[model samples]
Target: MHTKKVIIVAQLFISGMMALFMSGVMSVIHMGFTAQWFAQWGPNFLTAWPIAFVASMVVGPIGFAMARIVLRVEDAV
Candidate 1:
């Protein structure tokens, strides 16, 4: 029942935050928290954000459907 605009806005915010956190975590895991981490993370996050945005748009509906099915099954138990 959510409107398309609301869904898109939610996806934008969620993907932005997710990309920010995951990019930092993965970069640090790969290179540690070096002084160069900021420089490295900048481009890395930039690359990831768009991909994350598009991917979320693609998978969001499927994920919602799966969650609904799982929750329904759980409630039936």
Candidate 2:
């Protein structure tokens, strides 16, 4: 039980981190691509973290499921 908990925690952490990093990179790309149109859209590039957090929340369970599948496959091997 303790091992399972630890594995889940680690999986969640990794997923969250990956989501955060991807969001940041995407925000940068968006800013670059929309620089010309920013005058109309305004400079709202600082909203990446909240978006990342929400994305992480949404993705956490899926990530955990994938992790479990991989772990099970490894154990079977």
Q: What do the candidate models score in CA lDDT, each in turn?
A: 0.91, 0.57
lDDT of 1 by residue, 1-77 (tens): 77799999999999999999999999999999998987899899889999999999999978877998987744332
For residue 34, give model 1's deviation from the true position in Å.
1.0
Overlapping backbone residue pairs in candidate 2 total 0
Best by TM-score: 1
lDDT of 2 by residue, 1-77 (tens): 34657755665666556655665556567666465544423233334445655666678658766998987744332
Local error of candidate 2 at residue 62 (angstroms): 11
Instruction: Look at candidate 2 and tell me the lDDT of residue 67.
Output: 92
Report residue 27 deviation for candidate 1 (angstroms).
Answer: 0.3
Q: What is the C-alpha RMSD of each candidate to the true structure, in Å?
A: 3.9, 6.4
How far does residue 35 in candidate 1 sit from its true spot (Å)? 1.5
